[model samples]
Target: MGNVIKMDVYRMLRSRSTYYILIGLSFFLVFLINNSHESLLDSQKGLPVPKAIVGIGFDGNLLSDQMSLLQFFKVFARSQSFILILAIFSVLFINHEEASGFTKNIAGQVQKRGWLLFSKFICQGLFIVLAFLVGLVTVLAAGEMSYDEIVLGNIGQLLKEVGLQFIFHLAFAGILLLIITLIRQAIVSLLVSVLLCFGAFAFLYHAIDRWIQQGLGIPDFTMNNYTITGIISQVSIDSAKGQLIRAVIVALIYGMLTVGLSVTIKNRRDL
Candidate 1:
């Protein structure tokens, strides 16, 4: 597994397409952060920034009307675009390997299919974290360039937010791995992963919440609460203990189930 992870990481770093996407995502996230900074400053000029950031940390000093570091971080974290980027990263990572028949070659050298899945998960998870760091730096640079104040708000809270993001992205990688492992086609797998992630997940959340909870009269049963977005969406320093626990549970459940199923399919299917 160690050797497998190292090789995958090496291949990922070597891919030109990886760098291209990194450059494009960094620029786009920076633009988004800058644009949000202006709008937030305008609308929240005299308001108290919500103490509990919805997905990260909120601006504690909204009265000053400047974009603080935490608020800027929140801008990037709370956007669904971040989730889309993770899905794209995972899909492309695996899809490219499949298209190149690299995995088949690896299977010939390994007996345990789980080794391949685990290595890909770790490698792609690392890519997600690095991509997020790049976005974070870009946002900070853009904020400072635009004359916004950079407040390194509670370090503990900032670290917690980053940790939650890491878990979410890792689970997203698991989902993509399952899909690409089953589909084994580059364009189709890419399209399916992106659409299922950004579009289908949200739609399923709504349908279940509205139909199952309200129409079926199932008290306190919300499918959205278990969804990938729903789980990650509840992360905040001030969120209830129960909510945070639920988020962790949902993330683990999704990650394990997807990866486990993928491994089973890989072991049984003819490569």
Candidate 2:
């Protein structure tokens, strides 16, 4: 297991594409964080902090009562967060070697296919964490500069909320990476992952199931008077715990199954 993980890390770092992907993601995230504002932080004169932030729409409606670091993190995470970049990262995780035919050579050298698959998935997760931490630090820095202060009434609470959002979002990203491992192509996988992510948020059950409940799965936080919507749309995180649990479970299943299937197929192939 250690060898597998080490090999994955080594291979990824040795590859130019991997470094390029991380660098590109960093730049893309910084762009999102920077452009998410109506004007640069340096341009703000003396307007109310909430109003100044709300005007940018990077976080949420500052005029509302549900404003806080937790809510702000959730909103900012979706709008300007690098979850998309992370997801794209995962989808492209294995492509560099595959494109260069390194994966095929390794498959020929290895008798244990499971180790190869495990290493790839583990590597995917490692890269995800690496890339995410970079974005997290960037966001933290940007948050410091953007906000007048970051008072932590309960430091534990802030970490808990931020941590859960990070987990949920990361798991979502991993799912796409696993999907890519199955597809073994970069562009197709990336587009599919992005489209699914964007479409999931825009999609609602209004036109389908009329019996949707607030806590069925995700929390909805929208102010619209819609008769029904997923809990995710409501903005309350009553279901986040459950969502996190389920998302992790499903992502793991997808990751393992996809890796397993890919190995089986590759092993059976003539080349």
Backbone collisions counted per model: 0, 12
Per-residue lDDT over 1-271 for candidate 1, one digit per residue giving the tens place of the 0 to 100 score: 6788888889888988778888877877766655555546655566433433222222333323455555555556655556667677777777676678887888877768668878888877887777778877776666666644766677777777778777876787788888888888778888887776444566667777888777889878877577776555446556688987877777888899998998888888876
Each candidate structure's TM-score, on Cα atoms with residue i matched to residue i, is 0.85, 0.64
- The residue ranges of model 1 lying beyond 4 angstroms of the native Cα positions read 41-64
Q: Best candidate per lDDT, number?
A: 1
Q: Please estimate how well model 2 matches the true structure, expressed as its whole-model Cα lDDT.
A: 0.53
lDDT of 1: 0.70
lDDT (Cα atoms) of all candidates against the true structure: 0.70, 0.53
Collision pairs in model 1: none
Residue 172 of model 2, lDDT score:
51
